[model samples]
Target: MLLQHAGIRPHPDYRRLMRALRLHAASPRGELAPEVYPADVANFFRRRRIPVAIVREGNTNALRKILAQVRRAPVMALVRGPEWGNEDHWIVLIGEERGMLVYLDPWYRPTQRYRRRMTNPVFALRWRGSAFSLSRGQAQSVRRA
Candidate 1:
């Protein structure tokens, strides 16, 4: 909920998950930034001894694996937003509710969701203990979190 970094949009789901992981963003001067880079996210998990896996676009096999993980715990995802359909956005997937993939999207009101079939997720971030092992393909990349 805090936009402490310049040139970054507020992403509620990202913030929520980061807080859940007990990680905080800090600026070069040790001030709160409330913004993080992709590398920073990876580093946080690494320091916490969590495992991370990355799935690229159109990887249905990996997508299926992530979906299974979501049944047990929250997962972070990057997808193309509906607005203008050009921007890639981040959201937290908090598992299924009544057959819908519940979204903690910052751009929408609370409790907003989409049908699982409607989403075209490009990337996924899953942590260990809550997720199964990622099946890495030539298109999939794995990061030790």
Candidate 2:
């Protein structure tokens, strides 16, 4: 979705990406916990020549500015809720309304999601702390394939 938003008509194969990154290794108990975290995503983007900027609570003002520029920035936020059962989930930040953040949940479980908007307190309630915005990769160094 972020790739499409950034004008990559055919998004990269996510399955292949996971395999390349060696993600989702199962434990001896046969528990598969797929971990495609914020840092991993950032590295992927950088590897694929897609520029992205990470923001966190440490830089609240800058992050807030990025959040406000939804369409222009194309942001994805990492959040955790009771619905995820101690796991983190990533959602697209669409817009801001009435001082609340409007997000789109891409979680597999539909029943877990309730509404789409959240204020600062509400965001805190969900343990959302990090976000990244897609931008110009042209300025960054390109890797030789």
Candidate 3:
């Protein structure tokens, strides 16, 4: 959805934000070049006058920080894995009230499908106090961008 908002099409081969960031292809200890990924994403949003903060860290702490930042402005997280061969990820937090949308890219097909398929499930308890939702159409819309 954030990509839809940004008017950027999702790449078919690299369907997830992290895959598109080229995070999976790096060596085990490889580090993402600071200027390339986050800077580019920041600039894209900046052109649209949307505030973007790219946080690079472990999931729990980084997510905490992102939630905090979302209180002040829209946030798009560009998360990298601690080591190479680990998948990187991106999650976009838009609007206040704790609503969010995540874009996860797994290196393997099973993991990818699992994350994408489990957006909302029956018998699953929905998260309360502001919900995070993903629209299936948004992924296709990203391709149209």
Candidate 4:
């Protein structure tokens, strides 16, 4: 999704990379256990020469700071409970709407087919907020500064 947003198409091995990332899964205990390490996200982009700045587990205030500094849309992915699907969800943060955060939701399934959404910084219980914003690009950058 990030690559696409940056106008770069993934070469066909993306599925292999997703498997390697081990994103979205269930534990024997049947809890929400997605291994979405921010560094992993960063590493993938780094390989493509796209610098990514990861925001640690944080709150709306932290997000505000990121929104102010990002050159590209930030990727927000959070882990939710069973009621909210018990899987980690990812959204591309666009900007602010009214007082809410506006984002591009890439999820589309029989259960969830939401796209182009807006939400409160914290829309209730489920949020393990981890985000990564692409930094300002230099001459040899992927986003073609």
Can you write out model 4's per-residue Cα lDDT over 16-124, one digit (the tens) per residue?
A: 5664455545656888556656666666666666655566555557655555643356555554656457776666666666666666555555367554444554533
Predicted structure with the largest lDDT when compared to the true one = 2
- All models: lDDT? 0.46, 0.65, 0.39, 0.56
Give the Å shift of residue 95 in candidate 2. 0.8
- Structural similarity to truth (TM-score) of each candidate: 0.45, 0.72, 0.33, 0.60
Better of 3 and 4 by lDDT: 4
Rank by lDDT, descending?
2, 4, 1, 3
By TM-score, the candidates rank as 2, 4, 1, 3
Clashes of 2: 0
Greater-lDDT candidate between 2 and 4? 2
Per-residue error for 106 in candidate 2, Å, reads 1.4
- Regions more than 4 Å wrong, model 4: 7-12, 23-35, 58-61, 69-72, 79-83, 109-113, 116-118, 123-126, 135-145
Which candidate number has the best TM-score? Answer: 2
- Give a tens-digit lDDT track for model 2, residues 1-145: 5665655534446676665444756756787756666677777667766666777766757555655657575678787877677678887777777888777777635577633777867665664667777653323333332
The TM-score obtained by model 1 is: 0.45
The positional error of residue 124 in candidate 1, measured at the CA in angstroms, is: 11
Model 3 Cα lDDT, one tens digit per residue, 1-145: 4545434444334434444444445545676532235554554444434433455544455445545654544444444343213334443445442233433333335545422211322101222112122322323333221
- Considering only N, C-alpha and C atoms within 3 Å, which residue pairs clash in candidate 3? 10-142, 28-84
TM-score, structure 3 vs. true? 0.33
